[model samples]
Target chain A: MSVRDENIIEVEGLTKAFGDFKAVNEISFVVKRGEIFGFLGANGAGKTTAMKMLIGISTPTSGKAKVAGFDVFTSAEDIKKNIGYMSQKFALYDDLTVRENITFFGGIYGLKRQQIKNKSNQLIEELGLEDVKNQLVGSLPLGWKQKISFSVAMLHEPKIVFLDEPTGGVDPITRRQFWEMIYKAADEGTTIFVTTHYMDEAEYCNRVSIMVNGKIEALDTPQKLKEQFKADNMNDVFLKLARG
Target chain B: MSISVRNISKSFKKVQALDQISFEVAQGELFGLIGPDGAGKTTLFRILTTLLVADEGSASVFGFDVIDGMNDIRNSVGYMPGKFSLYQDLTVEENLTFFATIFDTTVAENYHLIEDIYVQIEPFKNRRAGALSGGMKQKLALCCALIHQPKVLFLDEPTTGVDPVSRKEFWEMLKRLQQKGITILVSTPYMDEAALCDRIALIQDGKILDINSPEEIVAKHQHVIYDVKASNPHQLISLLKAYPTAHSVYPFGEYVHYTDQSGEFKQEDLHAYLAHNGLKEIVIQPTPATIEDAFMELAN
Candidate 1:
């Protein structure tokens, strides 16, 4: 059943502060259901901070955020249950086998024994990981490990998946394959919200929000933003916006 | 040829690091080894520079075998790793001077070669390498790598983590370096960076997919390309993928780059279909293919 609610995430004047530094300042936007939203910024931009708020890990100092139809402050537990998060360096036990990692994460998400087994098998098979299912995660190649991490994040089947620089340090082919998996999930009606430093990856998002300093300077589809900025590509658009 | 490799392969604890990866660099050419992490890019670089050994194959720098003439290869090739691998504890000048001393040379010996980049970070020569900003660290690393007047340079993703502006500056520096007849073999994950190289080898999972100039790669993609945009791009991508004639549909910036299975499918069909499906503000325009388009086509 399609949720009639237009907004999966609603942020209103959200602010995140760390002592004297306001890492995020009054940022607000709505991420609709099943939309692939790209959050772009330089190294220290408030992208991470703002995402942290939406995911309910970091409390906003003021304003309001309703994610997965749960209030960020009061319904954090509900929000957590409705979301899956994958950081740049995803939390995968390197010493564990691929199957073991899948099981562990699935267990944590409160899946039953048969459900975890069935889902793990399905994920491993879909990703063509059957050959390496017994291999230690640390022993697997970077690209394979990234795919496994992403699969593990979705093991619980959350309504929204948040990936923060999931493609960093990997090669182009692996990135392409990783994006294919993301598209597959979105096709299944899972909202994908991700932050990336790569401009090309930003282009893959349905919509992108470019953050500068502590505020979002531009927000639109990659083509609109590129044309409005008079830039040939997202990289040039980002440079013109952020550097200015 | 400035650099050549013969049947070079490496393995790390049962993992095939590089499988007979062989390529050569012409003098003054900017060659790029484009791949993801662990595509054996760094491993290949280490072997070429004699920093690591290869189980099979051989490589040479300016006619000197890397294994047999390790010292000579080290003396003639400048290498910058993906990470800033310089001494983090030492000051910028100290690190440069230390590298110079190890090579039995001095910064003054090749001051002209590195003058442009070194000048930017010269004021911070006394500051610790660990304390320097990302861009400053990059410049310092470049200065140290070029201080010995090497004939060839190997940069393994030097622009990976640096900001876009800094990355642009770094590429400009490489262009200037190339102008002086230095053969550069740089590895990067960014496809856009491949355009900066005279030629590039696209690698995936220890296998070389395609090797050619960036323009040539794009030229090889024979497809009727259409860039389609609508009020709801996500919905549009799904709709496009579901279309019976859709050969491939992938997100391209704000629009979707789509190719049809049938040789001749018109944009009017797409517009009418999208409008019927409740998509609004639709615009379907033809666009020239890019390196990414070619890459995606090959991948599928």
Candidate 2:
């Protein structure tokens, strides 16, 4: 999949409101293809709301967003076909074995039987899931389940991937490994858009957009944000923007 | 040993949770068991607290074997689970009293130890624990754990879902507890938190990776670190990856943290390279490595 340098995801004055409350204000940003852009915010921040609009699952109250070269409002079905999503709550059948979960997700993505088998093998080997390949997902630890969920998200080889709090409760070591897989995918030309409460994880994005209340407070690299805010870590930078 | 494990292992259903993991936490030391979820942090904590029996191995707390001296271990240890396990229907005061009763102690006996944290939630002592805010719940949980004044404290991701400010506050509390001669073993998935501990043991996939202090880990980082920022940050990241000297370029907030293949590349060389690549408004600064950076280096 080839995408121009201009923008793979374009948002113009996007807005989403729930009754009198504006969940996402008039925010606009362009995400280039093959970049890992992070959405940063506190719990009540509008990051998730904005993502819902961009992914075509929730309709925007006004303005516009173009994802995968298709309008979010009119071409939502087409947009869904070109992107993969992994929610904070990973959608997987816990009762199924590792192999069965992979096959099921692959089929959902419309992969052929032989292609699913081939991809499953590569995934199992890359993730080192060989020992527990036949074990039920419910029996696996939280870290292993997280890795499996990520692999399943990329099974269909979509042009872009979206991850929501993909490493919330896992150990730091597993988080580091999860990011390696993310970098590998980015290297292979898959654009990654992720949201996270962990500021350090935000630092791992190609560029991050920080939300406060309902507006994009800051959009830059973790280093620049730290310097501009005169802070040592991403946590400080986030506190400066969010708390202020 | 204040805490000891020999060939300790556990599994939920068919998943091999812990594979003969054994370690010791000395008296009055701040020890960190660092790993993501399912790294057996919970399972190990349960075993040491005598809440769950390991299918294999033997663990002893304060020289009292876990299997044989379970009651003694329970009476002498403070345990705070990842999730707030206190009764939701009970008030803060009730929860504290309930836990104290289990260990044959009273809140009045250890009131001084928990006075600082308890005072913050004292007004809400009458409110049900479920109605308390996240930070408040954390404070209440901590107070209950400390009420008994156990020799060793087992905190399982105590700061997991709490706010950053509260997390910082919680660590400060732990440091204070350490000063009072309490041996603490805390687990967390946040790399930054690992630095606050005296020494950390990085665990993953049921295996121990490395054990060292935060400063030692960062000092051992063998890479020359550079932070790069530009007007068009995302575009700069894409450009940096294709640059000839680029070894690894990952986005770090508004700038990209990069390293070179030789670990000896100069800043002037980087500026020249960026200019030649049509990257403008660039800021390249050499920065000190953090524990998270060192953790990433070792993890890879």
Candidate 3:
């Protein structure tokens, strides 16, 4: 791989303005391939706005970024095709059966009918959902739904996947199980850009960036951040930064 | 007693949301219900607040039976549902006034009860409740809940999605309210917050796992936890779980928390075993068990 191809996501002086207020003010970072990058910030902090721009759903006010080697400005359509996105608020359809939801998402991602069938079978087998593949998603427990939603997000095997608090309000055992899946994915060379409220989960990332009031105040690995801030854990580091 | 429940069970269709749940809260106590999603926390809250009836057993709030004296309980207790229950279209001040008037009272009558919490949102008094930020919305909802100055307060997952800083501040406010002698029954998915309550009841699948102070619950955990770290975390977890004497292996932050099946297990033996597997820099340190660990153990 060339030097440029190693970097899955690249941004420089990225900023987004809503009226007179700048939601994201000149933030820049690079996410390497197969690296688990955690985007940490308080509520109302520009994380979501910045993420929308990178996913090619929202336009930026200024600056530049390249996602999967395509410019977010001119080649947003290409960027969309090369990325997979899933959020806790809006994931799979609850009214649809597990198999139908997988087929629907695969179709939307432009997969062939034969390929969708194969993908559905593989996913159901991996998730141990063969018994309930025909059941409505609403009938399953919260933990099962979360795991199934994650597998569906990887249906197209995009270059980068974005997860927004994929384990909110889930059981502790299931939450850890979800992280295990994340580790396996990263090992297979899929860059992960995720956000979460749990600080311990932040420590699992290869590198984390804490945004305070629209600026990246601190960016480093969890161990280095803890040492630099002279704190015991990521939660304390966050308290010190966001409180300021 | 501030609250009491005896064999309370409620089911929704085929799913047994709450099964034979029973507990009691003392007067002026800060009691917490710690559980994750689909654990029937919300359904129990509804039953205690007199919004829904239980299929079996009986409950009471301040000596008032939940069913026989529903009106009396509703008049003297405050409830904040898991979801944002305030009027989104109304301004913060308007929402507060509306709640106060519903109980045949005014904000001024209970000004002292909520002065500290209300002041934080007063600056945004005219802003629509929907326009406020997430943290600000939580503060406003809290103020509305306390405007009636009830003897007992029920908060359902008030800080579930809130940031750490805001969550800390919100708990401090609750502490102050406790000092004012208002009994609080709160619920949360975050285990860290459970330690702040005077007593916590760990509930799952509509049954109580244990009810006691957070310290007592952690003390009851039988396993001696060790924070184990190695060069390769993925391999370390699998190896630890593969150990014949290993009781539990969980990925916690930078280290994988491991426990042995026997209390007499030695750390050096485990360290040497990992060293033999081509694992280097293997460090194992004993760590104190937390309520989260106890909850998981009890649930298992």
Sorted on TM-score, best first, the list reads 3, 1, 2
lDDT of each: 0.85, 0.83, 0.91
Tens digits of lDDT, candidate 3, A46-86? 88899999999998999999999999899999999998888
User: Which candidate order results from sorting by lDDT in descending order?
Assistant: 3, 1, 2
TM-scores of the candidates in the order shown: 0.84, 0.73, 0.97
lDDT, candidate 1, residue A227? Answer: 88
- Model 2 chain A scores worst on lDDT over the 10 consecutive residues at A1-10
Indicate which candidate wins on TM-score.
3
Highest lDDT: give the candidate number.
3
Off by over 4 Å in 1: A1-35, A49-82, A110-115, A125-128, A139-141, A157-160, A169-177, A183-191, A220-224, B12-15, B91-93, B108-112, B118-128, B131-136, B230-247, B260-285
For candidate 2, write residues B30-74 as lDDT tens digits. 999877676778888999999999999999999999989998998
Q: After superposition, how far is residue B54 of candidate 3 from its true place, in Å?
A: 1.3
Candidate number with the higher TM-score (1 or 2): 1
What's the TM for chain B in candidate 1? 0.95
lDDT of 1 by residue, A52-134 (tens): 88888888998899999999999988899999999756569999999999999998999999999999889989999889899
Choose 1 or 3, whichever is better by lDDT: 3
